[model samples]
Target chain A: MKLIGENLNIMSKKYGAALKAKEAKPLQELAIEQAKAGMDYVDLNIGPASKTGVDLMTWLVPVIEEVVDIPLALDTSNVKAIEAGLKACKKHRPLINSIMVRPERMEALLPLAAQYDAEFVGLLWGPEGMPRDENERGALCAELVFKATGEFGIKPERIFVDPIQTPVNVQQIQIMSVLEFMKMFADIAPGCRSTIGLSNVSNGPPDHLRPILNQVMLIILKRHGMYSAIVDTYDTMLHEIARDKHPGLEALVHKVEDGEAVDMTHLSDEERSFVKTAKVIMGQALYSDSWLEI
Target chain B: MTFQPSKQVYSGKIREVTLGSGDKAVTIGGRGVYAFHSFEGAMPNAPRIAMEVWDKDPSEDWAAAAKAPFGDVLADPAAWASKCVKEYGAEIIVVQTKSADPNGDNRAAADVAATVKKVVDSVDVPVIVWGVANHEKDTEVMKLVAESCAGKKVALSPVEEGDYKQIGAASLGYNQLVVASSPIDINLAKQLNILLGNLGVKAENLLIDPTTGGLGYGLEYTYSVMERAGQAALTQEDEKLQQPMIANVANETWKCKESNLSTEDAPELGDAAQRGILMEAVTAVDLMLAGADVVVMRHPEAIKLVRNYIAKMM
Candidate 1:
């Protein structure tokens, strides 16, 4: 299982600015913290570095590589940037952010992965945007496996399939679709592993509720063969909950994921619920004595 | 497309495992594709057969068909091994530690090492020294055999998870190949290989035995599992399972009740000798198709049949 640290990326301007100026202190801090938290790879996404993507990557690769001993996941769709970062990477099995079933993405990234001897994340979507259901997602994933392995000659185990997880607020049933794809990832490509963009489920949800939603979805997806994740490794709660704290959690998560009532008698309604920690954090739950116990 | 074969593109080669030192060495595996699937990928080394010979003579208990080929040399393992490499066309020799079983002669490790030395000197083709499935006794005997055959690189067989540390340490110290054996489970098989690697055994010094299942008795299960391991080796680049595989098919087939029965009782089965030989041959062929790199078998006729089958395919 690969626990990827995905905090330092171009999604936020704070992170973007840090990479733009080749800032080392803040990035080094994140790398050391993620490395201490048992992350297999610290993902480096340079979305704001788009214009100078290749240049920024060439600069940031050695900066992060100097401080962190763990491998770095080069998070970008830019081919030149990925190659630049890969060249700068030394003694690390740098993991590529993604490729897809689309002709351009597959033809470009798959061969790059083979040439650089790197593991890659194959996104389960083409240029036409994300799949609406689990079946299409699976089909696309299978196509990714078929081409990456059958054509590009990359090892199946080296490829990690990303079943695109969008915000549940936008696509309510997406939670189930991604989970279902994770369940079938093994059969799609026997030795291949599944990964999810952790924060995607919380994209439209409230800022305070994001981590709770992300953590819950992570636990649920992990049950269905989700091994690797593009996750914020600094979230102590996410790391804590990853171990499967409660026994009936799986059944409860499944029931809720399937949009059915949990039949487990052992757990309380709040305990079986998805937004427990979020409600507590937002002061919606009364400060009862047994509140922390649950 | 000519109803084309299912082709898989793989970059990882099953580690070409070499046995014996200097001039006598023979390599197995080193193919980048599934066994005999040359319509797509290259199978560099044609799978070899290692004939089995026991240290002590079995005058009567031996299956009539099995004993017929080497009737005179049965008393002396050296002569038997010599005959296998010399005449019967054995590419390699397998010396079983069956007599070392506590139920049988219970020969001590030192005594067994002397016999091993005799066979080692008799045959130039590399030897495989296998133990009774017993963990403690096998550990002792295999370690002594490792010491006796130091620098010779004879493959030491039946290195189970329980006794891996001892056997692995010996292989590491003596610089020999270790046969990482597991009970028909791919995961268990991979784990043993990983443990052996951690014990300093090089990838080239490893061979996998995925515990061969006999014909008509869960042979399909072995086929699927072996196929899975081979796929992992080639496509997944799983170094643990990515080494030559040796199937003790003859031993498994011989132990089955179907192969041992005389035609007098089961007369419908036809000639007992021919039936037994076919059973061994068919099992070896099935194992080869399932990505076996070296097949350890008994009987001259089965060896010839398997060899001929391999020749036509190659």
Candidate 2:
């Protein structure tokens, strides 16, 4: 699985302070570490940089580029800031962190993405906001792809469609909806890659139990042909599972996905936790902060 | 509308592994696409054949045609290996240590190591020492073989899950290559490669043996697993499964009843000689298509047939 580092975000407390101060050291250090951790791309999530969006992106893009060799995903709500970051990317192909399915966002960002010849993630959030089900996601994907490829002349291969992951604790039904959307994504927009904000699944869960949900969800998503994921690069075990170095764990998760009656007594502690977490995501078991304890 | 062919864009490439050393070293596995899909991407190294030479004389049980080419040197593996290289144009020689099997001659590890060294010295090309599947015996014999041919870069085959530690350490200590063997399952194959890597086997010093099965004898299973291995290496970009694969086609193909059953015993099966050669060639070709980097083959005619097929395909 291709990993887009989600650690260097403007939302993190330390990095957010550093971004506000325009400090380059902390961001550069984190970028280098993420690349060493085998992140295929680093997401520069300068969330809604409304005031200093353009200047922060223009300055930060080159700052991060100078430190790491991997590509950068320019993430922001500011249209001009995205274009500025795209212009500043000299070393690698830049990915526009998102272009929403909404008309105003598409009209503003699609042409900028096409002009820069940049790859963009197609976020399946319609004008009414978050799709009701897989069918709604599918319809939004068709409209976004048709405009991106048909009108802007952008190729499908360059677009990554994100079905928008929902937290498993409160939005368990949407967990299955996104998976259903992923199953039909290729048919809807052939050659378009897919990614997800993997941490979203565990958003409402306790901090200590978040990695388990993310790891299990990653394996389940990969089985359904997820191309990439925006993930916590520092989670060593999660990356190991992504590289298929832990087949035993992946097989246990697959067993839960396949609906096999797993004998819990025979599993190791880690394998048993993976099974439980997968069941929660599949909605076979109720979600709780102490699910692993159960 | 233009007819645009839907070609898969692979994000990974197989790590190239070099066998032997000096002038005659052969490198395999550096392809960015599936085996023989050169039109889509680059397959820099073509699949090769390493003819097999057994440690013990097998004229008693061997079919007449399989035995005909090396009749003069059947008793001596060094001589047999020389004949394969000097006459038949073999690029690599695989010394099958049948004598070390505890159920067979039960030869001492020292004796087998000497035989392997002799064969390695006799050939200009790379030598691969194949062991009996018994873990304890292969560990003992291959450790000595690794020592005897230190720095020669000869490969130790069938270094399985049971003996990867002992043999993998010896290969690292002596600068030899290891063929990581597993049952015909893609998961087990990747797991073994991961184990070997954890044991410090570098990417260039490893080969995958997914446990070959002959035509009509679980060939489909082996083929599918190999194809999956190829896809995982190139498309899924799974680092552990990216090593070039080596299929022991000769051992599996020649031993099957379809290759050995005489026409008198089974009249409808046709001539035993031609049938065995075709079976070996067909199995080798099928395996190459499914991503075999090197196929251990028997019978000069079968080798010739496979060479022609590879040449035409390339």
Candidate 3:
């Protein structure tokens, strides 16, 4: 499984200096920690720097790249900013993160991705809206895969598909959609890899609760064949759990992926409540106790 | 969809274990697929034989088939072992400690150790010290045998459920390879392996004996058990069942009634000597295909036939 550090985005803007004269100490620290925690790639997302997006990404890519040689995901809403970061990444090619089904952005990004020989990331969303069901997401992903191979000449193996995760608080159906999309994505594009911006699923939740939400979602998502994850690589607990692999965790993940209720009687009351919340979000069963102890 | 054979992908590999330190050493296992699935996996080391050399005298009350080839060396184990390696090109020598059996002469441990020492000093090839079925007697004899061949790196046998701690401790102390012997039960075999591991036996210092049965004597059950153990090692990635296996083919085949009975006694059964040799040979070759890495056998003709079979298979 590939772990991507997602700490250097607009979520922590104070660490991103104007000209990087203040040494960008926090940015370097997070990169080092993520790399040490066995993250195969570090994500450098200077979110929405419209006026200075290109310059900030260009400066930040090298600062993180200078410390760790692992691959970086050049994430930005603007296509030009991703291109600027691509130029600065000297040694290892960066995976472009990411593009939707918008034609204009796809035209600018896919060719640059092919020209640089870098792997690309594509989302399930199009110009109209995000897909509401599994086959809808699968059809959209299959279209990108066909175009990625036939039009741009980028190999299917090089593209990483992100199904565009939605927070369960807003719409619960998306949890099942994400799992189904992940399960079906491999068959849709045989050699392509499946990934998720894992922290987004826990968005808007309390900070203390976010870790459990993110980790549990990752566990279930992995069972559905989500091989790559963009997470807080600095969280030592995630690394510990990953290293100490357990059969029970896989059993629970398997049950959740199958959309069946798991036997959570062995877990603590608090842990079971969290799992119960997950069952509600995953649509495996109807919500019973909203006043549950989570 | 077009039909395609699903390729087997495994997460674990058999540990390659070597006995006898230097040039004449033999290593087995380490393949990641079924016995001869060389197209998908590696088969690095070829299977070898450990020719039998008995501690008791072979002349008295022994079958004529076994005594024909080893007539002169029957009384002397060292001479028999030397003839096995030098004349027949046997890969390893197995000194069967039959004299130490309680029902028989019940020879002292020192006597068994002395014969083992002579065989070890006589043969350049690696030696395997097989104990009699008596647990307490084998523990006593193997302790002495382990001291006799300290640095020779011999393989000690019959480390069963009851005597694993005793035999396992002796093997560890002397740095010898301990064969985890179990009945024709895969679970018992795996459990005994776990016990040996708990006794501090490294993966590289262990062997498996699923207990051989002669041809027409429940050989199918033995074959199935061995096949299942191989599947666990290669496909399912169970580490404990991964060690190379051995079967005392000569012991089971020679003692069978069909092989030992003469034409006069049972005229329907043809030549007793010829039938005996074929029985051992057939049992040995079948076990090899069923994933036995080492086979201990009598009769030079039987050994030759098995060698020819392995030549084509390996």
Candidate 4:
């Protein structure tokens, strides 16, 4: 599985002139921290806050790359920023945050990807906007896969299709769509990858809602063949939740523990055996109270 | 004296059925071993390819290399089908009713039906009728068209969760095959198939479209999903999901500007037509390798390339 770290978390001047005078840690420092924290790739983004706009991405990407050897997931809404970021990136190969199903958007972004030999996240929604229904959305997703592979020469392994996660509060069936889109992606493009913004589904909900939704979604997505995601590296609660849901962690730990038969079928087994193992080895100071204390 | 591979040969959606009388028919879903492991057992029938025809004029953005052959015939579906069969050697013709696009000219159901009838009548091989993406309009348009070609054994697609009832009923009434489209997830794919099954739609009458991605468009993710689904269908033996798979190649292939736009835009990229054809060919090959039973594609060159590959594999 490709490891991904969230981009640009600290309030920085590069984000905007208004934020420039703020005392937040530099973006470069934050990236180095994430790298030291064991992230495989640092997600870099210059959202609406950035003063230099896309120029900041081009400027900061190299600085972050200089400090860390990890690959980058270039996260930006601005096309020019993506281009600049792609140019600035020293990593051999980077993953583009996304190119939605809109033809114009795909036309603009996919060529840049092809030029740089970069991987991309292709969203399912087209110029008409996201379809309200699951089947339609799934069909659109299927269509995007076809376009990405059949029209563009991008390799299947390099592409990651995002099914466009919707907030649970807005639409309940969207949960089903997420699951369905993951399955459809597996069946149609067996070699392609799938991912989503872990934080998107919980947007506008309570702070605690994010972790639970992300973990459940992650487990189902992973089971269905998704192997990568764009998420906050600082969200330890969410990370723990994801760790608990991972299908192979227990098995791997069991192998390490001299093949102890861990009854992974029940939630209690996860609490007793898995949580206990983490606590014993990592110590109370290192481990969070969320998984073990619960 | 002999070398043996570990995995067995299993067919998941897209096996060729041979009748006692020497007639050959294609069916999907049979599992005795893993894919392409003939040493383990009989691995009969490679996947088949379907040529695509649409109602709209071949857009200017289409690669000149691929579009030159179809030139004037691109305007008419019947001419396109005839050209594909006579010139391209297509075994099956897939006609996408793009003229039914609600956002576009919004042609009436009768207009869509007329085109479908013309294409169906023009070809002796089996046909697949794809509805435009609009749900309400597709339901309204496809019903009359499916009825028009009743008992002729056409494949009608894109029956999703919200709209399967109408499309499924239409397919049943017409004695046609229905495609069940699910997103990239496995459980939902299974669930949708199960839902279709509950509606009295036999597994054989259904084709599972798991959705696909092109080369740069998360194709690996799509490949993994399809591979897992195929594995699940065979190893887990989920009855509902053990249907043939269908992928519409042309619709996706033509959309990418790299394939469709002129090479003048990106000189570093060579020959738009060949590039476009190659993209489709690569996508078809990937899907086939990943266990897709049927591929619906555009461009005669791509069709030819896939056919030759299939021949070589056989």
DockQ of each: 0.02, 0.02, 0.01, 0.02
TM-score of structure candidate 3 = 0.53
lDDT of 2 by residue, B5-80 (tens): 9999898899999999989899999999988899998999999999999999989878877998888999999999
Q: Over the stretch A66-110, how does candidate 2's per-residue lDDT look in tens digits? A: 989999999999999999999999999899989999999999999
- How would the candidate models be sorted by lDDT, starting from the highest? 2, 1, 3, 4
Give the Cα lDDT of each candidate.
0.81, 0.91, 0.80, 0.68
Q: Return the top candidate by TM-score.
A: 2
Q: Give the CAPRI class of candidate 4.
A: incorrect
CAPRI-style class, candidate 3:
incorrect
True contacts kept of each: 0.00, 0.00, 0.00, 0.00
Give the winner by TM-score: 1 or 3. 1
As for model 3, its CA RMSD to the true structure in angstroms is: 22.5
Query: Model 4, B17-111: lDDT tens per residue?
Result: 21111122344445344445446655465577888888767665466776788897988889889888888877778888877888977889888
- Worst 10 contiguous positions by lDDT, candidate 2 chain A: A285-294
| Candidate that beats the other on lDDT, 1 or 3, i.e. the better one | 1
lDDT of 1 by residue, A102-217 (tens): 99888888888999889888888876888888899988887888888888788987888888877654454566577666677787789887787888867754576577677767
Q: What is the C-alpha lDDT profile of model 3 across A132-227, one tens digit per residue?
A: 889889888988888888899998778999887776544556878887777677678988987888878767656666776677677677667776
Single out the weakest 10-residue window by summed lDDT for candidate 1 chain A: A281-290
Maximum-DockQ candidate = 4
Identify the runs in model 4 with alpha carbons over 4 angstroms from their true place.
A1-294, B1-4, B8-31
